[model samples]
Target chain A: MSGVWGHSGNIEPMFQSATAEAVEERLQRPRGWNRRNSLPYTLVFLIVAYLGVFILFPIAQQFLTSFSNNVVGVDKVTWVGLRNYERLFEDDDFWFAVQVTFTYMVFVVAGAVSLGLVAALLLNRKFRGRNLARSAIAVPWAFPEISAVLVFLWMCNPTFGVLNIFARLFPGIDANLNWLSDPNLAMPLVIALSIWKAFPFTFLVILAALQAIPREIYEAAEVDGANPLQALRHITIPEITPTLLLMAVLMSIFSFKQFTLIWLTTGGGPYGGITETLVLRIYQTAFRFFDLAYGATLGVSGFVIVLGLTLLFVYAQQRQDRARRR
Target chain B: MNRPGNGLLLPRSLSMGRRDFLKRTAAAGFAAALATPALAQNAKIKIPLVSWMWNEPGRGDAWRAILAKFHAEQSDVFIEEAGAPFNEFTNNMLIQSQSGKINGALFHTTPDLVVRLLRGGHLEPLQDIVDKLGIGDKLSAAHDHLRIDGKVHGLDIVTVKFGLLYNSAMFEKAGLGAPASVEEWVETSTALTKSPDQFGIYSPHLMSEPGDFWFILQQWAVMFDGVWAEGRKPQVNTAPVIEGLKLFKTMYDKAMPKGTDTATANQMYANGRIGQQLIVSAAVNIWSSSGPDIYPSLRSVVPPGPSGKAITRIHPICVNAHASDDEKAAAKLFVEWLYKPENYQELMERCLDVVPPYPEAIRQEYLDKQFWAEGYLAGKSITPLEIMGDYIFFNQEFGNVVMDKFSEVLVANRPVEDAMADAQQELEKASERLFEGFTL
Candidate 1:
């Protein structure tokens, strides 16, 4: 009986020793040369290659194009290094568009994240028809952008738009306001539409993060005589802070690149470029004016801005990782 | 292999060794490979004739019918319709030109786009076709811009001249006749307007539709005998141009649908809610179909201002220079056939077009039948080249600067003089970089 038990234990050690030897052999080999390690490296190479072709290549081309005199119908295309950049520096419209982009980004990010957080907190509570509420909140995220723009155009129509009815309900308002055409209201209305379209995505992400929190933490806080608000302030918020930071970075990116909603709504005008962002400016320069070199210069500037956003995202992810470890 | 539902069963006699099977397959494939190009050569060369008119309502059907006729009469070539909507077509073509080749073997270009394409050398000179057709001496003055180095690169297919197209029923109901001067025009328009229910006039003022706005905006200055530029020098700050902008503002405030888009404005015009539109002659065909009730009552007149001149823009059909030699030859053949006196007359009639590309393109009898033809013909024809001057190549860019500043005049009630002054400065600065390395 003793011999039988010893033989079984020896078989387990033998299996362990064989696996350890294989691992040690792998470690002894030079990095990235082992046959087994090639799978991950190959996968990584594929991802990097894909990004290089589709993303980095275009960016490199645009950077090169920025230094050329490449306007359509020009007699010849030649390098005019720094001339485009000098023009960009002096361009009033480009600066105005930059200012508009930042304004739009700040408003949309703050509006989306705060609204999403509030909605997520409310929906986090157990209640009747909670599933229906959760599904209902995601509808805007599912709606197509072009379809939304068309519906928004109809709703803002001065003559027959349903928005006019609501405006008329106000005390001082007697006539239908020119909603999109009024320069004062155009930016605000465009921002509102963007928020409506964008908030649902943030809401979903925040809700997922909220659900991931353990119920025991809350139960423990309640046992310590902490009220709902205190528990929310100490437990809920601290847990979700990383997610909120991540969402802010993502929403900033989203609003930074928003084009179709604002374009189809106001076309960067009721007068002037009251709502024009850098993307629209880039399009107007390249496509409308056929000033490809200047457009490319604007594109390079936009790339720098996107690079900054990527760094912000990386920092946020690192912070989230640190928090998770704690 | 003979099992049910497994695969097709080959007869034992038809079965072959692997090497024999491979050889037979290779021989059959070789024969197909050899025969493919021969078969293709015998088939009609299908060439796409790209034009925004293919997407237009009545114009689309008219062009398709003309294509069918051309197909019926031909054996060596077939023409197919290809194009985007009007708003996108010019930009699409421009992008194609930038890429060193246009998409189709043939394409129609707007008045401005034709100049750009000609300068880019994307158009094969159609002088031979015009000369072969014997219409060279009779081409309209609007075709002047299509000429380069004494060779015509394109042939005019449609000439849309601006005019005051109005719903006569609305004017009749309001007891008004067409105004002969600017003051009367404003008074008549204001009197006809009943806000929210009716608008007396509409000229695209919204920045959202810059193409239509700028295109028609050029004509407003023309109404006052003003040219936007003269030999690459902007004349936006001139008195006539200012007056023209002021007139537009007055009409916008008191008469026009303040913020209406072109589509909605057209709908309003069709319903008799809009009295007048300072639009092109080609638009009449659209109204004839969309607004059948008002179509019979529609009449056009010389726009009311000091100048009776209207901008006559010729859209030309050109063969793509970059197309294969075979495709180019086939496309030119279609162009020649389409430009034949009889075919051209039939096309003009079907399109409800009054303007003839030449003296003989439209029969006098047919011209006499079009009641809407008088105002368009009576108005002096001012080609875009004459107005835009050397800036003809940079028309949209020049127009954008003017439009942007003038938009303030309409929306924020900025003084026209101040706005035009700013536009003049902007245009002067832009001209430094705009005409570099290019000759008129």
Candidate 2:
């Protein structure tokens, strides 16, 4: 885990014995900040850089695994030119995993953000137990993801499951649905669990944004012959849209990167490799299969995809916001 | 049906068959692939018993008892049994075994690994230890599991058979004695499938790993006609293999009861509804739990085979070769003490109708009292050693490739001979490229 500011050679010796004048100069504050604070900055940089070796290095290692042509039992690398990448490209299973991931993110984000906004708008006024409810919404985020996944696995069990028993009351629905086992059902079930586990974050963010909206703007709207709906649309929504966009981006990244929950409930199997996310693939390749190079390749692929989407999103959002501002 | 987001390549399985063909055509060659414990010279040494089964509660706790007994006032040296899940026990030890993080491990993997482990000097050579310990004198030809390149790797528990473990009541109704041969097993299975209401055997074909189809079929093949490993080469695709396939296909085709959906089934037999479970004998504890409402009454008899002898596959036994000299010596001594008939009897007697590993370990007094076998059935004892010794499990690379081919025949509906041909082709290829890394 190397810090971005780290050096290849030891910087420790450079900072080992700084003169008193240098130390004193670094401590002194000036109007434009003329003095070089190399000692303190280097120390901070090195500390951060040290953490990168453990954390970032392993991540880099996973990215490396996804590319290499290492078989589990075999010890040599045959270096099949993009053979792994080529295989991954043609794999119907990986395509399904990608679709599942997209569906999960899109459906979850839509459900959580819209529902969260409504809840936040409804709870805008001071009410009894309001703070308690707001805090309670954040509670799901604190529960361990593994525990939540297990709970979902149990609730979704086809036989003797609580959800199936209750679902039976519906006239046309099957009495038993092996939610996790069905390739058709696993993603939707995972989407439901993801929404359940994640909506609270949206609620918290939206509620904070809602509270921060100035009452004066709404008062002006009301005075201008705007009904409650128009006032919310014209004033409230415009005010919180920026924060909502930011939260959406963050939440999208969070959902895309979510691993533990999916890994726990369904070991990314049943669809013959469809359920496995790129991250899960990285994990399996690096740890389970010990194809570190291939695991690393998965990480790199996941990174480029996620990064490209995020950048494209930010660029589009910025352009739209700038035009509106002008 | 839709394309995956960020999917960069085709799937492994679809391409595996084709790539395997090309690779096998290119490789088209073959190759061949432990030891007893060492005594702790100074009594200050400690070595690890890296095994898988000890992860279960009783076995893990019972390991402590054995260690305690061995240390019985022997002042200083200690032995620790560190167990992980079956899958992880070896790979975890590999880092230590390679980097010398920890000494010796007891694990099971392809027999092809023996040459690499010995080549990199990752394991201590053990033929000398067996000679020094005089264990060979006690047991005839038992150390073959470890013998590779004319050297030994580790002492191993023999192979146990994968077969139909039937209830006596069901057998009475079917009028089938222990299947005397593979043909009889097929006949009995088809007969017992009598009405749509009952099935002869319970098998988990859909279990995650396809390897299990081989685990059971190999036992049957070994009995009828014969498939074998000589100098660690799998001369399968023999008559025995074809006969074994037909036998299994016969069972799967006509036997398995309807409504016994095995999707992600963790325990089909624990509930005890199946007349007979075709599974490994390791599940005895699940069937032996108190409360008839909860558990099932189960016993095992040999499925009569082509040779009139029912054999099984054995879990492997190994010692750490990478331990310090003193530690290696002590590990050998400890293992020797452990394999002594008394200790062997102690471990084998628990929780199942397990056959003893060593021939001399099962005495009348010990067999009668051990917890797993006590009065569960009329059978006095069933030792895993009744199955082939290390020859099948650890001596050769053939069983694995043959097993995969067998799966092709059974599940994929490939012709038995064609699949065997493909299997032999692939296996011959796999044997050559098994290990190329020389780093220690």
Best model per DockQ? 1
Q: What is the lDDT of residue A194 in candidate 1?
A: 93
The superposed Cα distance between candidate 1 and the true structure at residue A298, in angstroms, equals 0.5
- Interface RMSD, all candidates in order, equals 1.7, 7.7
Off by over 4 Å in 1: A1-49, A174-176, A316-326, B1-37
* TM-score versus the correct structure, for each prediction: 0.89, 0.67
Error of 1 at B77 (Å): 2.1
Model 1 lDDT per residue over A1-326, tens place: 12222233333432466687656743454443434446799999999999999998988989998999888876567899999999999999999999999999999999999999999999988999998998999898899998998889878888778899999999999988988888899999999999999998989999999999999999998899999999989999888888888888889888988989987788788767899899989988888888889999999899889789879788768977887799
Give candidate 2's TM-score. Answer: 0.67
Residue pair clashes in candidate 1? none
lDDT (10s digit) by residue, model 2, range A105-216: 7887887788778878877778999888877877787888867865676677554457877888899986466566566776667777887788887888888888888888
How does model 1 score by TM-score? 0.89
10 residues in a row with least lDDT, candidate 2 chain B: B30-39
**Per-candidate count of clashing residue pairs (backbone under 3 Å):** 0, 70
A140 in model 2: Cα distance from truth in Å? 4.5
Q: After superposition, how far is residue B361 of candidate 2 from its true place, in Å?
A: 3.3
